[model samples]
Target chain A: MSAPAPKALLFDVFGTLTDWRGGVARAVAAAFAARGAAVDAHAFADAWRGEYQPAMERVRSGARPYAQLDELHRENLDRTLARMGFEGLFDEDERDALARAWERLPPWPDAPGALERLRAIALTAACSNGSVGLMARLARHAGLRWDCILGADLARDYKPRAGVYLAACAALRLRPEETAMVACHDHDLAAARAAGLRAAWIARPLEHGPGRPAPEPEQEWDWIARDLHDLADQLGAPRP
Target chain B: MSAPAPKALLFDVFGTLTDWRGGVARAVAAAFAARGAAVDAHAFADAWRGEYQPAMERVRSGARPYAQLDELHRENLDRTLARMGFEGLFDEDERDALARAWERLPPWPDAPGALERLRAIALTAACSNGSVGLMARLARHAGLRWDCILGADLARDYKPRAGVYLAACAALRLRPEETAMVACHDHDLAAARAAGLRAAWIARPLEHGPGRPAPEPEQEWDWIARDLHDLADQLGAPRP
Candidate 1:
């Protein structure tokens, strides 16, 4: 039987839509070339991705007040760049460019058309820890077709927090049941379901690399799909 | 010479974009007709709109905790429905529909194409206090092409606070200088400029209705457009 229709779908940005690992690697590769060095962009990408959680935990646990992802990403990038021996390769301008690459990540092959289809039905928006500015370019660059973008900054807290999910519903003028939170991460869906939003999982099996632990799907997600397009069909959105 | 383009455009939704004043009155007229009463929707719309600011200011200044526009609108709607002698005209269903009238607001005649054209050259988004869901519907209903939505909840504070404008810039990932905040209200633009965003004004001459203090486009806006279309032309956005 079909699930009840949602008023909106809030998608996770990093792995569910765009291939964050590959996207970050591509940008890292470009930066390396600009510096006349040949660094392992994949390893570099992995290193940056590795920092994702501990950074937020610092804020989540009240160890730090909220800081925007832009600043957090910059701190990690600065540290990683030095470790990678790309010494003095970036001045302020180059650093900003590398930072902006987050805004232009490529989407998964299935991302854009599915989003277009979803928008034709429920309102489609991004609900992610990525600051709004970062997510908007990623959508525009890869044609992800979000109807709106909701950033972590919206709630002043990161996902897994009930307030974050509720704030999204509050903004959309939707009750929790009227909204579906779609993400590849199990923790995200768990928190969403806890907050009363229906949940959908779009597995990006390659998010961490071929063998490393990929963020898994939640068993309680209302629907599951191989990617955004599959989830779009399950949601009964028109195929693009 | 043109003032350097402001980084973003803020909006005054009710009369500025959607003719809430007209539409609500008309919607209420239908709601009243269902009750066999001769309700002046225009007057009702005016009275309801009049109650908006002071209610918001009550929350803004901390006399009350922050409440969504949906809540504030509904509270005012309740008071006015009784005052209009339209008692027992609404139950939960009717009240829900009436509150959602804000979402179905029709755009100004000049709004849609102007925004589409503006998007071609500049990073355009909505900076309004509407709930994310309300703005989503407003944009959908009005064919507004905002790239990302910057609402009050994004900052956890309402307009006129530097935090609100600062949060919007942080979301767009643009410096306050690079982003322009556009709106029809003098106070909205003034707050944005004070918080570091460049400012543009579109005169909403009929905002408060005929001869109602004749609210003028008298602010020191860096770029004064007759409307969004004029602003698009001024910004060199490719005409759609």
Candidate 2:
């Protein structure tokens, strides 16, 4: 807490600001229901989310050229559907809509208000792996305002990469030290720290869904909090 | 107005959303006054702006590699001061602060509200030659909220370049035909049209100050209005 506040906070959107699992599952369930099919939407959502890292890895390793999250998500959705034995259940347009489910992900209960308070103290931007268009749609959907969108598209690289972190800071005209990377994942924070950025851990116990063991911090971050509201409080953000 | 409304509107920041002339002049006057010097701040602001295109052209024509607006603005400020016979009038730190005067450009009277209204109907973003950092700070200063920041730094090129327009649309996941370039300058609109985007002209009679002839439409554009409010009304944005 004694460390000076960062001039800006670059946030990891998926598990940090949003309840991606729950939101995607709900959308998946509705999509299936519309087709008179009853599938375990949570399992499907998990399967789709499972493909995320490897998809990004393909680009990160130079195995594939950079692709937007939208494209990756769509391809992953198709793969997930095929893996689940529902390959032909949805047509191209339906598949596209289902992929866009990521855009409608809901904010965690504390996210919107905490972000508002945090913005009063520092510039807040999404530094997710999601593309700018995806982030923009999601921000509108969830009522979470960002000063600007910065991530995969802008960086042409995904999270955990030094280039991604450095690119976001450079775009903001801030040195890594002047910006803090806030995320619910240890690996993201670890990579950010390695890239010379300050790190703040925001615990999201329900990020992977209920009954799964929650993640615990593996190392000291510049700031550690139970949730975003706690982080806002710790940062001395003004109350509404 | 026969064409479909664009899914996103890319704005030209310098003269479109904000009054760079008056704002920079005010800041220049304040900075000089602090040093007990009286000068024609407006002329100074004009000279600084006049250097803009030629400086950008250096990068555009590959005479210089890409540099953010901040760097270009700082260089221009120095050259302008030197040309005006005020070289060494300020220290480096002072010069840097004065260069940042661009970030505090005042919004046109109808800009902030019109932008809010337009946002209700479509995605809105800054597509100026300004760097993402400059646009972000300027938006905060002017109370103009953009869904995302796009332009020079993101595209690695300045506007009037086809890549700049196409890059902005690409970042939004929008086709050029699905987005509109909104600006006060005919040349910008002409470039945007040549790059396959629709165009809207918002006239700023006093953008260069009174006594200067207001720029008229040199050719047909998708939409034309005296100000942003008229543009919003023509777009059928809901009244607040």
Candidate 3:
């Protein structure tokens, strides 16, 4: 049976819309070079991102109350840098600038055009773990047009939690059945489905890095497409 | 002395960016006409809006907990229609369509161009009391390009309250000093200033109706201009 059309499309921004891994690595490398330090930037980026879930887990597990992704990002960056023996290498201003790297992520090749197309037919928004400020700045930098910013900060909970998906639907005044969660990760789509939102999976082979195994659709989704362009086509958004 | 440059420009949508009175009046008149009811449409529009503040006041005064503007607007519409001796004149679907007239408000003459220009230099968003869904639909219908939606629903409080203004600022991760509240109403600007945000007053003499006294600047706002276009020029946004 065909799934119903969505009134709104909630997007996972980091891996799906923007190349966060590549962008973060590049920014960290520049920051390190400026401070006269040589470091494995790619490894540093991965390590920092690797800390993402565990940090959010603290909040999810109630070990810590909700803190914005920006705050968690900075903390993760500090710990990652410390483990790499680069602790205190950058001062407060430098750290602030580095923490904002997420705001300057580059959009994937198909993201901007596809998003513009989809937005013409349906309400589109960022439904990610990023804070509202982080998502807004990233959208500004990357030209990702969103009707509204809906993120972990707004829900006061991280993704994979029911609150994040439900909050995005609530903010749009849409039922979960009338909203689709589009993401690259299987876990995200699974959680969205569990929360009653339709799921559309888009594969990003290089999301982790080159030579890594490309993500395949492991489970059925409402719609699975190769990329956002394909997803837009499935949704019947006019081609640009 | 010149005020600091604003990092973000938050707008009051109903009267400031849109001709709500005119739009609502026209829509209501059409609904009445369709029902073969000879009602004074303009007066109906005014009376409907007249209940706006008092309904919000109940929420603001702790007499009622937070309710979305959509809910409040519907309640007010029902009371107004009943008082006009047209109780149950329309079915649920008809009432819903009429209520959605708020979502189709037309933008003022200079609003689109001025907002486009200003957005080039600063983050721009709707900071009205409208719910996110309402603002998003209005923006789509009116072709108002907002970077993100912000308002009462996010704050769970109505405007003129500290929480409403502060919530927008907090969502954008901006200090009140770095954000400007742009509105046609003196009371809105005054409330914004009291909450530490810079305020810009745009004169909309016809906001209530033609030939009605235009509001003059009652207090020293950060900037006072004839309209959004003039405000954009003052802020040095390149004329489009």
Candidate 4:
């Protein structure tokens, strides 16, 4: 019985607003130290984000039709460089600039000032499976000021697929209970509350990096909080 | 030649950054002065913007399928209130709040400081036929700070269609000559330069309000400029 304060929120970029395993383990340790290789750059950024949900479960099981989380992060960076053995050590324009290291992820030091104070209290976006040109170049390289830029190429698919949370609340005409779905993941707020929407969460304890173990909320989420500047101070917003 | 400086620009919201004929003639003179009646609100905002391109040429001649320019401005505001006779004087919730007066139009005094210095040079959006919830409530009621919000509800259709300027440069993945449309209408920069993109224009000499002449550029448009703060000082964009 929670959702009464949403006009829009959406979000969930990478690990809920940047820090994709510390910017793809600092571009996989500067593309394996420009080739004089060493290895374990956060275990190759957890083997390219564990091949991101089995490549969006091959386009959510229809077995691929919708290609683009930047071509499934450049075909899951050639199977995370052939499952970490590092096959043919980078070419095709250095694996297209290491598949744009998830478009240069870096926010999360309070995710760009709590997304400029939760965008003055409402309508924010990037409902990410990433790729409206990788969330418009990761929201201009992580300053993250979205008012538009909905997810998975306007819901062709992906996300705990409720048509990507009802196509980011029908591209803003809203009303999936007037939108909410922020996330740090409780299976993406139980698939955005089974698609009727309204959820919040937050808590990205260094999003699988610093010391690891950061998984907490497993159940009820209408508004949890801790990181996005305490969900923009529990949604009141003012203090930018 | 003039295709070099763009990374993204797009734009074209109702008479290039708002003024929808003086904000839909001050919302059709306050809804016919709350019905005491005193019409001719700028000729009913030019007969509801002259039924906007024959209601997007019935969804670009397929004879209608795609809709949402807020349902063709609520069916052209009931044919601009029965061609100004005021048919049954405003009902369906005051014609759904006068078809949201194009979502509270009003920008254009150098459109929110030249779109905050052309979003600090480049990536700005709203390739407008309007409706991502009426350009996200007319960019939060006209402060207009878009980084994303592509046109014709993600190019379902409308605008001097070239699939609505190549579906807003293929939804930010760009490369319609790296994008650049801007507008004040030289046939919407000649259909965003016949869809290969790159154009600029921006004049808006009080956009059909003052002495009413306004539109000048009939051809050559790579960067014209005069209004969006001289196209953010010819795109160098520093002085806000």
Whose lDDT is greatest here? 2
TM-score of candidate 2 relative to the true fold:
0.99
Candidate 1 local accuracy as lDDT? 0.80
lDDT of 3 by residue, A56-139 (tens): 999988899988888999999899988999998998888889999999999999999999999988999999999778888899
**Which digits, one per residue and each the tens of the lDDT, describe model 2 over residues A147-239?**
999988888889899999999999989999999999999999999999999999999999988887878899989999999999998999978
> What DockQ does each listed candidate score?
0.78, 0.85, 0.77, 0.23
Tens digits of per-residue lDDT for model 4, A33-151 = 99998988887788778888998898889987877788777888888888778889988899988889888889887788888788787888888887676787777888888688887
State model 4's lDDT.
Answer: 0.83
Cα lDDT for residue B215, candidate 2 = 88
Give the per-residue lDDT of model 1 (tens digit) for A21-104.
888888989888977888889999888777878888898888999987878888788878888776588898888788777787
Q: Which stretches of candidate 2 lie over 4 Å from their true place?
A: none
* Candidate 2 residue pairs that clash: none
Q: Residue B127, candidate 3: how far off, in angstroms? A: 0.7
Better of 3 and 4 by lDDT: 3
lDDT of 3 by residue, B59-115 (tens): 999999988888888998999999888897899889888989999999998998899
Order of candidates by TM-score, top first? 2, 3, 1, 4
Fraction of native contacts, model 4: 0.63
Docking class of 3: medium
The native-contact fraction of candidate 3 is 0.71
* Best candidate, DockQ: 2
Could you give the TM-score of chain B for each candidate, in order? 0.92, 0.99, 0.98, 0.35
